[model samples]
Target: MKKSLFTFIILAMVLNAFTACSSKASKGGGAKLKARFEVAGMCSNYTFSVIEGRINPALVEASWTNPQTNKTYWKAFGISNPCNFPSNIKEGDTFYFEIVPAEKDSKCAVCMAFYPTPGKKLNIKVVQ
Candidate 1:
């Protein structure tokens, strides 16, 4: 009987300690990916599915790479800095640009996605 009571007390203490320590980090309250995408596209209000490849910066110009087309565009779509992905982004403040494909069936030069830049700024270029 005594052992059982002591075990219960120890377990209770451990659980309580864990709960208290776990909450040390304060959550700043961030919007989800869906909300972030929607906010970014307030201009065009575009939304798309997740695709392969990471976000590409708008540094290389002239020829854009798109994952959708697997080809390069003659002219880059112009994506600027401080941009975030169209989907699964943390904050709405992140800026994002799409790689304009050269043709109907081609890859976005920046990302090389089959369908690049659904809900994003039309033209965002890397500053010289």
Candidate 2:
């Protein structure tokens, strides 16, 4: 009886572990969005602007509206350590990407000069 009880407990623990892992994987694991690499200028950190998908408004740190066209641009900074921006993609190239969390100690060096980019940045990875 004790052996059966132990086996049952082990099975339950394993099932629980799998359930937790699956939940974490699906929570923030599937947010691919389409964007174009629009370089604002030399000083801008976020050059990838949304082209075909919507980003969480809360993640938008900076935005610009073109008065003539009435088009709005959204920008987010990409974390470089874990995510290396694709080299083949050039300015104005459209690509798919997903938002990711920046590491606790991650940092990107930049100038203090003002640039037309969202002050808020969301770590993102280029998805094929």
Candidate 3:
């Protein structure tokens, strides 16, 4: 009976460890940047043509105007499908969003092609 109880305890601990690991992994074990942006316009190849070569024309270009500095910071999202575009947002609308690296130092060509200009290899999600 003692041996059986010991085995059961060990199994329970293993199960708990697995559950914790899986939950953390699914939640994206990383720090995410949360910010708000005012949609400036849709990004096009012409926008990045000189700076970073041709790019995915479907990207959304947005900017955050710093209240303190009164400067605007720009970034672009690689969301290509028009259907996936957030229904609540429109051009010139300010929205909250989060940016997380797709992977550590991930340099996705399609997403990061406009580097040094306005694009980066990160996953962006609207925060509703």
Candidate 4:
């Protein structure tokens, strides 16, 4: 009986150790998520569309090109050039902006959002 009790104690200890290790792993497991992409270059009422979205690496870099009209949409993201704001895109111009995600699918959803800009507000699918 004593031997059996000792074995059980040993088994319990082993189980507890495994459980603790698993808990630690879980605490450090998942990848970091990034913020969704959005632009307010167009009318506050109009919404921008995501042409293509894929994870490149740690940084999410996206540029816009008006497919239908053959124009650049850098200003949509509040940038003028590759590293400039307004993207030199004038107001009321039909532009396309590629929305890139920060982190991968482990966390953030590949979604889009638009903040109201002056007279026009970008359209969003949200109920509210």
Per-candidate alpha-carbon RMSD to the true structure: 15.5, 6.3, 11.7, 15.1
Instruction: Compose the digit string of candidate 2's lDDT tens values, residues 23-108.
Output: 54443346667877765444434455666654555555357653334556665443333235656877778888776666777564
Model 2 regions more than 4 Å off: 1-29, 65-83, 105-114
List the global CA lDDT of all models: 0.34, 0.60, 0.41, 0.35
Number of clashing residue pairs, candidate 1: 24
lDDT by residue for model 3 (97-119), tens: 44333445543332323312234
Name the runs in model 3 displaced over 4 angstroms.
1-34, 43-71, 74-83, 100-117
Error of 3 at 33 (Å): 5.3
Which structure among the candidates has the greatest lDDT?
2
TM match of model 1 to true structure: 0.22
Best by TM-score: 2
Q: TM-score each candidate.
A: 0.22, 0.53, 0.29, 0.25
Scored by lDDT, model 3 comes in at 0.41
Deviation of model 3 at 23, angstroms: 16
Q: 54-127, model 4: which lDDT tens digit per residue?
A: 22222222444544455553322222121222334433434333322223233322223443422211211211
Q: List the residue pairs that clash in candidate 3.
A: none
Q: Could you arrange the candidates by TM-score from highest to lowest?
A: 2, 3, 4, 1
Error of 4 at 2 (Å): 0.6
TM-score of 3: 0.29
C-alpha RMSD between model 4 and the true structure: 15.1
